[model samples]
Target: MPVEPSLRVAMTVEQCWQPAPGGSGTYIRELLRAYAELDDLSVTGISAWHRGSPPEDGPLPVPVRRVPLPRALLYRSWQQARLPRTGGADVVHASTWAVPGRRAPLVATVHDLAFRHDPQHFTPNGVAFFERGLAIVRDEAAAVVVPSSATAADCVAAGIEPERVHVVLHGVRAGAADPAGVATFRARHGLVRPYVLWAGTREPRKNLPRLVAGFSAAVRAGADLDLVLVGPDGWGDERDRLAGVSADRVRVLGRLPATDLSAAYAGAHVFCYPSVREGFGMPVSEAMAHGVPVVTSRGTSMEEVSDGAAVLVDPMDEDDIGRGIVEAIWPGAHPALAAASRARAAQLSWSRAAAQTVAVLREAAG
Candidate 1:
């Protein structure tokens, strides 16, 4: 009888919560869901805990183990030391910058080097954390996984070997139109008609101040368009800038569940993401999947993700962003653009990303 090959894989989830709904959290959830279905692999997950206990019972196709750390500092130290013991498996994958000191074919995912390149956009602590973590990633990780070729380039520019970097795109969850949900979300949020949607945390890099300026300009031009900003209110200065805009013309919806977010996307006339930097820009793909016309940034991952499906603008140019929004809202303006957006979205899927990730793990294990 042929013996079954021993394949054990360890996946790190440093900042993920099992039931949370943020982007990184969602990425971990989707990755685990896909990894669970693989036949020949035994997977283990390690994560950080703060508020509640980690879920105990997981009939999850693979075993999941959560290691609780007191704080981010402790977590980083644990990542550098305790990970090898925690991840007793043959291969280890760090989803974020939390690198293991004693590496056994380590694969690290570098979302973006934004904190390095755009220090003005981040807090001092954030910049320091990224610099330190990235140093560990460069020194320890055998291969680096980036969400886009743009990010891969960023990694190479940061002194990582280009050959060691791989680009694996993120996928949006498949969702159907929910009119009632849409109406409920709109009503609850006091959303009126003729709105453009911008979804993401209110970070300086999101360029919300610029977006507000552009939107206000469009509104002044008799566009009569409202702007909807969805995501968390983590940005102090950016939030204040957004608040300075006319409240009647701008609605900040904080964060919404996936279902409502889909409906919100469906209801929007166009999705505008003028982020100055991004790893993959999942929201752009999500907007495309929902058949919403999109206007995004020209350089960085936004352009690569949009693939001519959406209007590409100079993010720094308020005039360009405003004009893009106007063109998107004009009736029967860009049929080809809309069609291409959906086509581009159709090509991106979570399964493909998982398959690629698994292949990398398998290769590294060998």
Candidate 2:
């Protein structure tokens, strides 16, 4: 066997310390762990000075070295002053667009151009910050990596050259769910049998209001499954919407530990994630990996992640979403849909994502 030449990688991991640590945090952790299993590269995590390790949810996969400032100051410095250059590696990978000074060839992963798609999704300052980051990516980055063709199209529309853009789909790390743990999870939450599952932050972009409405419609149409919601509370006042919903049937089980979450996926009758948009819908792929038939948005990245194994609907239409959910759980659908979901999910793996990322980083360095 031949040995693969390796390069040192300085990859930003600041998202790991964030309080919410959404999908981007997952990206940093999973990619580094995948990198550790490979001989193609050696990665050193980069973050601002912080008191302790990342939250207790998981272990750190790589050693980290810090910059001189706290998070806010460091982010400001990167966007405007471009200080404390990233020079200790063969190439620097800005895990998100909050890039460091370009002391080495810089390759940046842009999760999505959500801010650009609709400025209202972000605060005024957030939009400005993202604009600054995108400008830097356009002018300074040796390569720009995106998670989906949908996001790649958005990047080009925002004026990044097509040739510099690379689409690298995210990996699925979801494992088989435990039956005993799943039963316990159901009992603990007072969940009824054959429930439809929805996971992800409760934000405007997640389109929860419409999901709730659609779910109500599904129930009205005589779909037997109850609806179960999971994940951390994001910004939104869904009270008014949920008030009209059948409170007795809907269960809002907030965040769970990873084991229980996988159990939730394992036990779902249908996984419904009709968010308005996504760069890559990690949860949808995760649900599919668990062999649950999915109902997701028709044209977004979630549809791509589902790989034709899911039922697609227009996210903007509560009625269409309702129809899709009903279809997914319609009689005589589970066996084939579940089989396809597993097959499509089998195609995604972290080792593959790690190798593709290393190739891009090396291309930037070369």
Candidate 3:
């Protein structure tokens, strides 16, 4: 096969200079890792600096250019008086609505329209910022990339041209299952087997209050299962949802390293993520990649990502969520469900997403 010509691509990775409190950071880093493998792409990463140089995450396969401007100043300037430095590349890609001035063809990734759809999940300032940023994206970007069909539809609803929207499903990496490590993680966190795992930030959009209510109901129904919540404290007080639940059965682990988190996924009897809304539920796919049976919400991208393998329940109904959890974790459940979950995950790959993203960037460049 003849090799495709290399495309000059400049990506704004200011979000990656620090640890990502959410999935976007992971998306940026993983996409970059896959992009680095392409011989037909020359990539440049751009970030802003305020006081000191940008922090490095080991050695990247590509070069990075740090603009000597604070984040606030850069965003303010980009919105009004200044332009982001893109090093004159053919295509300038913003990971999440951080578009630069007219330097190159723009490819913007709109993670979600949560700011508009669910204002309660964000601060007023945050909603305003996204409302303004998305306007720029819709008005100026040559191509728009979304993680799921749901977000693609959102783009069209927001008045972006349908032809300009592309849905590139995110990939999942299933690491080798470590039995010993799984045992260690359980012992370290005092977690028992047959626990339902809930990963992601504790936030309103995640619908943790309902999840906790459902878990409490399941326990009340004599289902002997523990509920483990992972990730950092987000906007809401999650404990308010766990009002009457027994302390011994519910574990709140703030955060664990990737290796341990993978082990937790592999060890769990079932993974539960009944989110109210999502562009793409990374935890659901990640759990599926580990051959774990999943219970997620219906009528959202979580259902799309699960692809008929997971048990879908109404996210708002605590009783329905509770029943779904009981059925999913029942003894001698269909082994094929676990296999199917992994199979669904196998179909989504970072290499494929990277190649498609590069193609979109090339098209926009032309």
Best by lDDT: 2
Comparing 1 and 2 on TM-score, the stronger one: 2
**How do all the candidates rank in terms of lDDT, highest first?**
2, 3, 1
Better of 1 and 3 by lDDT: 3
Quote the positional error of residue 191 for candidate 2 in Å.
0.7
lDDT of 2 by residue, 266-317 (tens): 9899999988889999999999899999999998998888878999999999
The lDDT of each candidate is: 0.77, 0.86, 0.84
Candidate 2 structure, TM-score to reference? 0.96
- Superior by lDDT: candidate 1 or candidate 2: 2
lDDT of 1 by residue, 1-366 (tens): 884475687886645543433466567677778876777677777655445443422233445565555546555675455443454777888777665544467788888888877898888977877787788778767788888999998899999999889888987765676778778877877887768999987778999988888887777767887899888776458877775457888988877766777788988888999999988888899889888899999987989988878888889998888998988877777566678778999998888998898777777777
lDDT of 1: 0.77
Please report how far candidate 2 places residue 75 from its true position, in Å: 0.5
Winner on lDDT between 2 and 3 is: 2
Instruction: Kindly provide the TM-score of model 3 when superposed on the true structure, using C-alpha atoms.
Output: 0.95
